[model samples]
Target: MFINNTWYVAAWDREVGADGLFSRTIIGVPVLMYRDSEGRLVALEDRCCHRGAPLSVGRREGDCVRCMYHGLKFDPSGACVEAPAQGRIPPQARVRTFPVMERHRWIWIWMGDPERADPGLIPDTQWLDHPDWRSQDGYIHYDVNYLLIADNLLDFSHLPFVHPSTLGGSEDYASISPKVDRLPDGVRITRWTLNTEAPAFAKKVREWAGPVDRWNIYNFTLPGILLMDSGMAPAGAGAQDGKRDGAIEFRGCQALTPETATSTHYFFAHPHNFSIDQPEVTASIHQSVVAAFDEDRDIITAQQRSLSLAPDFKMVPLSIDAALSQFRWVVARRVEQEQQQAAASATGARPAQTAA
Candidate 1:
């Protein structure tokens, strides 16, 4: 049920270090990642080709991994270099390697054909690495499917009831209307509230004392990435007119990676342009976001449990679900394309792309 022929966030750059090997399951594949002797990262199938052993349990020798169950050794290229007690290595003694790239402080991996993996397809998250911006990175594991969280990001109408204390105000929960657009690759949702009261979290982060103009610009990119640019400015400030000189802007980079059919790994980074040098402000923002996501985790898990018991239950569409429906359509189309390509490849045939 996972999309293979696409790039997905494998891990945050700070997560896998040079000292130890990191093991993760992606799209039902057990993968191992680690830094070689040169401090560069490598991704490969975690299973040993010979004994079905997990290479992650082995020792790291230079840039190669030695299987602990047996004495099989695999190089960074996934080639079996040494096999103890065997005089010669078989031709099939190798593990599969994945195309990996480290950009914007995130390790991205391609689970399909390496030739089709385009680095340009990865969304631009350069702000998280800018010198003048302050960023906080956090992670959460969800028991629900990643699509469920994607639906959550596309629908803000639930904020009033779900995040009443943080992001949702009395009127913003279900009243604020969003303008939705289908991007070439994903969906975009934009909503601007003029001269409105800021919520508790927004007030704490932006230090807005009274009413202010706020904007929520959320872009859901391909596979599963949501880059949200939101902020608040003084009341009567022409924020809609591009006048944000005194405004506090916060950009959040959220990447969702599926661990299994029913589990997901959420990596989120909150970057603010206002507090470039304040450690306390960064810490506060991080805590607030973690709390907010924790709130989401509770609700998503409960929904997942209920859905598991009732798989055929359909979500009744509503006015507020317009954007979410479009988001789901976009994702389903991409997944279908990938599945078709895989089937074609299995039959030794080439698949043609449809014109937009």
Candidate 2:
């Protein structure tokens, strides 16, 4: 399981309304999120202390969340500010509040110890600031473990068989070799080439002119975020050189937060450079990609069910799975390191021995 100690994309900042409540599950934990009257975002454990009802089901009252069950009000800090029934605050009455921040139009939540929540820990995205890139937001729910989806994203080999209609045409099932590189600050980059004719989507872009060569950069930051650079260059040009020409590039970032062991909340943003600044052109590109993603949703969800039923099932992987293996190992190592740090903290908190 992915550790809860890392940062996960919660929601788009614009999606959270000042007077509305939103409920979402992150890493299998139900959480209630909202913005205060000042437009500051806040997150708290969803359960109401009064009767265990979800706080999100309640209404907002003067910057506090008022429970519908008994009119109990909780402040942004999770304090029971008003309990009409009791008329006084109980010593033990409080909901767990989490650290949240808004960045690049997205709301991010820190699920681990609040003391360790550092906004700087979130991966830096300088490219988004570039004037040339145009950004689009998308969301989807997947009935599968977040890991399965992560693995799928890291492996391009499945494109031919699983996503032939969408982004799979370049998949040459026979000769795919993936390479992985570890970078500083818990960053990993996976690279691979899919050798096949361009898919319909790529062909559409090709109609503008030039042959097609696809080069992919699969970047995995700590926790559950994935940044993908899917670029198509003129055919016959080397992979590196293809990027220099007027190629159609799709840069997508995905945040997969586990709703349960078998369900996940998938949030994605695609910011591109080609014809994206224009609303009409951007809408056309967004629609095309969304159609492809809908196709993948069916394939990934079924794959998850199949894997769950047969725990021992293992298939021979092609060379393309090398990067995936690297990714899995990196995640495992990070989780292990976090566990060790937590254990060490616990040991240091023990009471000291009295003088003998």
Candidate 3:
């Protein structure tokens, strides 16, 4: 159920260090990543073309990686350049290389055709490294499908029940329905809760005299990327009207990469524009967000277990399911379109070979 042609978050920039080889299973394919001698990022199929040994366990020789199993060395392009024991390297002795790029403190990899990997299509997440905003990188691994996490993100009504003490503040979040708008690649959801008590985490970061007005506006894009602008201000501060005076602003960035059929790699960070100079404030916010996510993970994993037991059971829809349903449709359509295109290409290639 994965979109093969889409770009996915391979890893945080810090995960693959200058001299370290990192490997992870993305969409069930093992990927080996590292920086070349010139410091350029490289992503290649982890399996060595010879004997099927993983290249991650091999040794790095300057800009190239050498498979220690049979003494075959490959360049950054995944082309076999040397075979120590053979007179010549076969033309087909090469591993597949994926299109990879580094931006916004994350490494992005295109899992399909290299020719279709356009850097411009990558989403903008400047808050991740912008000077005005401050945040720390956070990553979590889940033993559940990535789409399940996406479902959790699209609907906020569960916050009051799932994240009661942390992200959830009051029942108003569950009672008040949000506005869901369709986007070209995904969906946009906006919700406002007025004159409500701040969540426990918010109170730890800033002092609130009484009730406040808060807004959560975010865009969940294809391949599971969420960039959000959520914040709070005093009850009469006019935040809902677009005035930011005396407002505590935060930017939420989250990326979900499918590890396998029932597992996911979650990368996230919530940056705050207000406390740019205070590292403590950033740490507190990060800790709270992690705690809240732990709560989400506990319930989502339990639900996944139950789903496995009842594979034929269908979930009933509710008003809160609007955004998630739309987002799932967008995903399904893209995946179907990709499958159709692949089938067409295969059909066209067969005819060209027959004519030749």
TM-scores of the candidates are 0.96, 0.88, 0.97
Candidate 3 CA-lDDT value: 0.92
* Whole-model lDDT, model 2: 0.74
Q: Using lDDT as the measure, which candidate wins? A: 3
Q: After superposition, how far is residue 300 of candidate 3 from its true place, in Å?
A: 0.5
- Candidate 3 residue-wise lDDT, 1-356, digit = tens: 79988889999999999996899999999999999878899999999999999999999989899988988999999999999878988999999999999999989999998999999988888989999999999999999999999999999889989988999999887888999999988999999999998999999999999999989999999999999999999998899999989889999999999999999999999989987899999999999999999999999999999999999989999988999999999988888777777777888743222110
Residue pairs clashing in model 3 are: none
Clashing pairs in 2: 211-235, 212-235
Q: Least lDDT summed over 10 consecutive residues: which range in candidate 3?
A: 347-356
Error of 2 at 161 (Å): 2.3
lDDT of each: 0.86, 0.74, 0.92
Clashing residue pairs in all predictions, respectively, total 0, 2, 0
Tens-place lDDT digits, model 1, residues 247-269: 98888899999999899999998
Q: How many backbone clashes does candidate 3 have?
A: 0
lDDT of 1: 0.86
* Per-model RMSD to reference: 1.5, 4.6, 3.7
